[model samples]
Target chain A: MDTIIQGKAYVLGKNIDTDQIIPAEHLVYSLSDPEEVKLYGKYALSGVPPEQGGLPQGNIPFVTEGTFHSDYTIIVAGPNFGCGSSREHAPFALQVAGAKAIVAESYARIFYRNCVDGGFVIPYETSVPLTGVIKTGDELKIDIEANTVTNLETNITFTLNPLGDVFSIVRAGGIFAYARQENLMAQS
Target chain B: MAQTITQKILSRAANRKFVDTGENVWLNVDILLTHDVCGPPTFDIFKQEFGPDAKVWDPEKVVVLPDHYIFTANEHAHRNIDLLRQFASEQSLPNYYDVGTDRYKGVCHVALAEEGFNIPGTVLFGTDSHTCTSGAFGMFGSGIGNTDAAFILGTGKLWEKVPESMKFIFEGDMPEYLCAKDLILQILGDIGTDGATYRAMEFDGEAVYSLPVDERMTLCNMAIEAGGMNGIIAADAVTEAYVKAHSSKPYEIFQSDPDADYHSVYRYNVRELEPVVAKPHSPDNRATVRSMQGTKITKSYIGSCTGGKLTDFMLAAKILKGKQVTVPTNIVPATVLVARALECETWEGVTLKKIFEDAGCSIALPSCAACLGGPADTVGRSADQDVVVSTTNRNFPGRMGSKKAEVYLASPLTAAASAVTGKLTDPREFL
Candidate 1:
């Protein structure tokens, strides 16, 4: 069940607050709709949602929904992602939406773990240059099995940590499927 | 080898006689505390990562409260509180304080000490950075992420980087208008937020000894802005009495050796220090509030975990007994205990809330309402309407909700004066 996401890598700027993660309005009753949560970056995609959401949204968010990397599971951001509040919901919404891994310059200590503890999402660190090297609509091919990221534009490839054996199964879906597979193998 | 409190805790956690730089240590957390904003997230992760029957190490060692969003601005936040309550119900947690529920009240910092949930000489961690406030109780406490916090809940242990020590020896006498809030704000303005990154500040010396436990707590409470593991004032008789009064647990005293290695040492002669402010976008940018005098202020906030102490109210109340706030001001106690303490003994001869109320100042609950920008508090509406004044900690840009609206860092007294006059006014004038 190893997976890799490669496409134009869209860069969401740094310090994206939790309210911007899923927005207080989209939250339906008590249930968090991850499908809709994915729309959080919409303002960034066009620099319109924040203005559309009220405040004059600036170009800083760097939203690129229709751009090449918009569909990629990997998002590279600046330092201190999930900086404000101790909200696990931010990462929950991120993973539940479509992100498989988040590569940031750095992460807020609390939010980073909430992401990992929630599921097997890789949060790696790299130089800030990676943001410019990545372009919207540029397809990045990542091999979940090999733990490598390849830039189609530069033909450069980088290796990342394996999702760990325990997470390899959980990343396939949830713990139920993971435990089911482990149990079936044991029976076999 | 002489043992300091920090060294003792590190050695005990590392299972060694001494610790070296860059050493990995496993330490048992003395207490695990969290607030509403942090509590639910950790619970969700605990449920998924550890399973339902997961055993929380010591229910009695755990303290959880609702502070960040106590009233729940909307339905979603309410559901989040419900989840935390459900988790608490199942775990039989010893110290669970729901908002406005019994005496389990106010800022997380005050509540933890009030219920005797925290003991000196033990290591504690919470989901909030101000958890360092507990270090004033003479124990090592720091803030960590939900991930690390999750492991603490499921495993009761955490791996820590042995923090280097920064010693601050405060000597000399306090001049007329100085207090703990002013001292720490000056420290922040001097060092900036990154000054103590990953280090532990040890407050010692004559002035530190003279400081009451409550004032010392204020010092450690604001240490989070220094970006350190925790700020600790080694235990003395003052600490012992506080611990014995608050908890029945046996206590031990820990101190550092005179020859103990240090990353750095600082000496402050506060006799010459003035009320200072670190301007916006940086907590280290220092300037005297007097220099920024006459700076127009729109909204003034005088309470949060850091600024909201009894001495805080008393100091401001003494000056405000016959005065009024210049602009609309909000003087809030960090917790209900602080509010209640203010009501005790017409101290300096006047109750704080009553004085504030008479002055047309609104004294609110013991919540972190405006500090965290938790609704009803934002600095500016497009730079055109931004307000500026000094507050308790670092003023990183947009830290208080408006990137353009400037935030100035200062002591509670400076803030109180500004609130009264609606402009950046010095406390010296009020006195």
Candidate 2:
């Protein structure tokens, strides 16, 4: 796990549900097949209304057309991000699209758990709203150890809530790895 | 040692005398539910973590129901069913509901109830968010992601944070126009989408207790819409009767202590509540059906784990008895049993199925058709810029297909009334 992560930001509004992150229509694809798994990246966040996709200016696609990976790697959003559905595919799609971390006001429990338990991406909760302050494409760096995210473009840093009990699990990569680390499961 | 029903249930699952709210504790899961959409991926993870030849911790404890994406031409969707069959065969699971067979069930959540998987004092975890629907049985049920589900597949246990419950007491008798859907929507409108995040929503009061098990399930189904960990109601005679009718398994009932602690308490009078709809793109964007009346709609759909139950159909049948729909309306039963019930269940000497057919509504084969806007060929899926009034939960953008399309979530009565006028109509108009 990377302690210091940096990337361009993709900002979105509140209540950005799992459906929008990865539409149900595309859920039919196999998650384990190497070839088919890439499709998750292709359609990541494709369900957000065009006018609210990338936020601030809006209408900006998170994953560019005719491509699988996204240019922006960090997501900054309003409260209750990933508020609907319990699809692990949402965070998996984001990770496949190159997002490393998300700094939001809050997140739905299932999505949050998926992020850590799947080792897909780091979910960071901010004390204050970062949507208005951080524009899309703004270069940002997250310091996991310090629990802070800095907007390199504006040189502004925001404190994030501590990862607390789940940090060790996150550090181990995912629940399976964490279980192995703690001898909770027999290693195959 | 006062505790809410949720805490008590968790305590029992944890093998503890008491479990404090916000305390993370490992629970012995009684049942692990999965469906087509998530079952395959979960199996993949389970195999990857556990050895390739390793069997499930307990085949009897795992319930797999293939409902989503059924009846679609999409090869991937069909492939998912094959994967489920393969896994079930390998694991020798006793509770696998396959598609294209008499054993098939429409939706996982509803099927769980019909198959007697829902029992009070038990803990259930499913890959689908609507798993909370089982909380109506006075059980602890919450949705988990594939990773967590996979963990449970290998071990019959998973850790969960004890949720501080929020008490919602609905006073007065439920009016003629109101159903469980209206009561839940009323709460959504007040609390917004994230109102109950990481918390238990315990429904109480005389009005809540008066509802049948099916209606109680409706109230709990939408708890996820409010970001609730679970929505629970104490098991009473009604819940007990329903459980006993479906299963011979012995079960214990638990209730919140008199001095139980709660995160918050909300009071509502059913007499003052009205039929409501969650308009365009969000479940929290609620409006009274009367206020949204005449809003044009191109389609009306009644179905899903949330709204496709027999009781929901009964409500719709009452509204569509002798009326012709002005738009394309689709009636989808939540499960195979529900589909059969529509044929046998009657009101005023007319079966529920005939009521919809006579009203110009198309009754589709039971499955989660168009509720989540599945495959391109999904029945009742919305078209570009199409406005639909549906009995399904969630109206997020592109939820029912067509990114430009809009969905208004309403009760079966409101959906049927709206179908008659090709617009959003209050159920009170028909009642």
Candidate 3:
């Protein structure tokens, strides 16, 4: 059963780097306690730190703190969702942060597969013009079975297919569950 | 009448057939790679995907490098290393690269290129996205997920949709101290991070002709950082010189036609670029270091698969002579060879290793160690207020340690200068 995250899409218009998605700092940190590592944590506000001058003051609302974190599911990105190191910790953090699936105009192939393998839904090919279609807080439904996303507020229905069987493994709750069911020996 | 290098390679790999635009198809994988952190899971899934007696799809096509766990502070990482060793022995795979006696063989991509595993006219994929780093040799390479990596290991093949190609024509000479690192940073900053997503980046131009293979590699390696498929240069005298110097194995050359189709064209007159930097939290954020030089860095690291080359070492050693690093620095040569080359003092006037170590810069074994903040490398993002300038790609927050930390991207010279001053200063200041 594909779950529908009933919240508006927090959209980033362009140029999303992997560093911002799952920063290198969070890579080893998540191994200790994944729940603590949110994809867009408090640092999203201040451009990451005092050193980087933080984010734009008005953009604080866009940080995952006050509003971005509440019930958001589908992250509609411009393109190239996963572009940096082929670090699996990337998609792992995205899944841990409660991102149900991602709807992008296009996805980095490694990122797409990592999303599917990590039990997070990432679909693309632009079923609809991503530009101007999504607004923050527009409730959306993603039916995993049919591999389609419906923007309830805008009445926009987008078609997509998960990245092959990797989706099935992820849908089963990470690769561990799929491997366990299939008698796969997961590393300790 | 015109076929791009990518179309030609993908077509040949796909049974000598011609491919048109927007066709949903899968192409053959030329090379497959795995590292320490990602290998255990792959072996586990692969073993389950096929029964015990399952022979590998093709042993020669696979490459295993124990880079992630070359050394680790945790026991779990140790156990993973053991498991990888067990997997290698059970399969009788010979291409497996453990931390051998070789010094310069650290990161898989660097080691592969240095040791001549990456050849021209082939398709390559590594579990690491930086696999695109090998594309400097004129090969099609990509980074893939574990599932795809596992599938390739089981069946010795993977699928791909033939991608669009973009032609980058560069003209003029690259300035001194302005190496391939600057070229890549410039491209990433201009095109945006996702600019080349799913497209084959073909590096062509007279300025490109001026770049050495390693510099070209930095360009190709960072291709994936822009969400590109592969970054390649049309084979030329330099490539031929590289192949002749590096390998005795016979290989064929791959080229593109003059009228080859491109999704778009990016023409840069080398005379046009200025020093550039990708601001923190994203790779595409661009500005001149001159614009943002007001900030200071607590740490400056100048070695990785990206910057830890012989020339990189020579350049660093030359600059750091009689100079001291302002921060606690570590110039980790990604491979034993680069480390040894630095140690030998053969190429430069000063011993690079001694200059680095004498200046309180420790030479740690290459293990993608500090790059990910494990053990001795934990960045105090929340703990320390110091910002870091690094030569390694990706300046995501807490990349060095704490979430509150800052990372500034720059060339080796810039990083070396920052290391000396504990601030984001230019190499010219030190010189």
Best by lDDT: 2
Candidate 1 lDDT by residue in tens digits, B302-397: 777777777677777766787877777777787777887767736456676678888777777677665655443222211334675644453544
- By lDDT, the candidates rank as 2, 3, 1
Displacement of residue B288 (Cα, Å) in model 3 is 2.2
Residue-by-residue lDDT tens digits, candidate 3, A1-188: 44545555656544444555655443333232334445434323222243222112213233455432434556676656565667666665555555566677777767766776555555554645564666655677776667677889768787775556555566676554565576533321
In order of the candidates, what TM-score does chain B achieve? Answer: 0.94, 0.99, 0.94
Clashes of 3: 22
Quote the lDDT for B215 in model 1.
80
Number of backbone collisions per candidate: 27, 0, 22
- Candidate number that wins on DockQ, 1 or 2: 2
Model 3 over residues B324-354: C-alpha lDDT tens digits? 8877776777777677778786434567777
For candidate 1, the per-residue lDDT at B182 reads 71
Worst 10 residues of 1 chain A by lDDT: A47-56
State each model's CA lDDT, in order.
Answer: 0.66, 0.93, 0.67
Candidate scoring better on TM-score of 2 and 3: 2
Docking tier of model 2: it is medium
Which portions of model 3 show Cα errors greater than 4 Å?
A1-79, A92-99, A116-139, A143-188, B100-104, B346-348, B375-383, B428-431
